[model samples]
Target: MSVQPMLKVERLTKTYAAAHGPLTVLKEVSFALAAGESLAIVGPSGSGKTTLLGLCAGLDQPSTGEVVLAGESLGRLGEDDRARVRNRHVGFVFQNFQLVPTLTALENVLVPLELRGEGGAAAEKDAGELLNRVGLGERFDHYPVQLSGGEQQRVALARAFINRPKILFCDEPTGNLDGDTAAAMANLIFGLNRERGTTLVLVTHDLALAGRCQRMLKLRSGAAIDGEPETLAGAARGR
Candidate 1:
């Protein structure tokens, strides 16, 4: 039998009230992500990629439709309850490394555990292991400012994975990195998903990175299009 999807979006739509009238950013968008599957979303600057990510993650409410995460309907939950659910089941990585400057790398990773009321020796041990997995074991005590852009991003990745979330959402994760560093980061992301069986939903414009995912969806004018999987597959075969 087929396993249930970890995330389900049904007729999802988002609209905002503009000066003139209602502006729709997403219209009847729907998709499903099975456990441990990785999917990439690609679109131009104003195509609503970020907006869709936010809605999927329960960080924002949709103007219509429902988002079911791990079998729970996000649209029906209140803000505090939604936040609780996210903490329990979701992890997020942003385009900008959102590490706190004052916290050490290890401390940054540990923050999530603390927020979840998971602390002490076990939390420290797990945080250390996650940082090590991201190739930052030696830089554990370094503050965010003390690290390079790539290093900081690694730290952010570590933090995101600290909870061993069932689903991870990444928005333009490698956007600010150089080509080589971005490639390295992409490898690390895929490696982590493979090892941990974490479902990944990523928004990116990098064709190389998007091609590595199991599937790709392109957004245009607030609607998602089923992209040609062969486009990425051909690129892989050529390489």
Candidate 2:
């Protein structure tokens, strides 16, 4: 028998209230990803890539259709239950790094464990190891303000993985970095993802970064195209 996909989205759609009535951001977007697979969503500024990611990650509800993550139907859950599901299986990295400015790197990495009311010695040890793995071993006590953008993003990476999440969602993960820094961050992300066997779904405008994923989904004006251009496909294949 075929294995069930780690994530499934069926006929997903999202709409927002606008002055002229409802503005639909995503329409009938559907896809599936197996465990440990990596997929990238690429699109222009208004193509609804972020919106689609949010819907898939259960951060937002679709106006219609369904999102089933790890065999759990998110569409049927209330906000609290959805949040619980996310906490249990999802990790998120954002463009802004999203670290608590006042918290030390180690502290930030420990937030997820603390949320689950886990603050035992084992949790602390794991948090420290994740930071060290992300090349922030010596920066564990540094606050976000004391770190560079790349460093802060690294801290975010460490934090995201601290919970041992099954799926990771990243939004414009390298948007704020310079080219070299972005490349390095991408390498680290892919490396750690492989190490942990985490399913990765990311929204990015950077074709080079998006190309690194196993599969690419293109969006235009809020609709998914059948396939990407030869150049994009070639880039992905080359990677």
Candidate 3:
């Protein structure tokens, strides 16, 4: 028998009310990803890539269609139910490195576990090991303000993996970092992702970054176009 997809979205759409009329940001987008597989969404700024990601992650509801994530039908859930499903199965990394400024790196990493009322020696130990694995063992006590941009992102990476999430969603994960720092962060993200066997759904405008995923979904003016990334076409032309 074929395995069920870890995430599946069918005819997903999102619309917002504008002064003129209804503005549709996404229209009938669809895709499915298996467990432990990685997929990239690439699009220009106004193409609604972030909106699609949010819908898929259960952070927001779609105006139409369905999102089945981790075997839970998000469209049928209330806000609390969706949040519960997300907490149990999903992790996120954002461009801004959404760490708590006042909390130490270790505390930040433990937030996910704490939300589930799971804490103590074992949880702390797991958080510590994730920090160490992300090369932030020595900086566990440091606050986000004390760390560089790349360091903060590293802390975010550790935090994302703390709950041993089934899936990870990255939104412009390296957008704020320098070139070398971005490359390093990408390596670390993919490394930890593979190590933990987490499904990855990454959204990035950079073709090179999107190319790293096993499959690529391109969006244009809010339309989904599933295919190989343009980078492959460019490579073929260059050769």
- lDDT tens digits, residue span 55-103, model 1: 9999999999999998899989999999988888888889899999999
lDDT string for model 3 (1-239, tens) is: 98999999899999999999999999899888889878889888999999999999988889999999999999889999998998899999999998999999999999999999999999999999999988888998999989999999999998899888999999999999999999989889888877788999999987788777777889988888753333243321211
Candidate 1 CA-lDDT value: 0.87
Q: Which stretches of candidate 3 lie over 4 Å from their true place?
A: 226-239
TM-score of 3: 0.94
Candidate 3 worst ten-residue window by lDDT: 230-239
Q: How does model 2 fare in lDDT?
A: 0.88
- Tens-place lDDT per residue, model 2, 51-82, is 98998889899999999998899988999998
CA displacement after TM-score superposition, residue 81 of candidate 3 (Å): 1.0
In model 1, which range of ten residues has the least summed lDDT? 230-239
**Hey, what RMSD does candidate 1 come out at?**
2.4
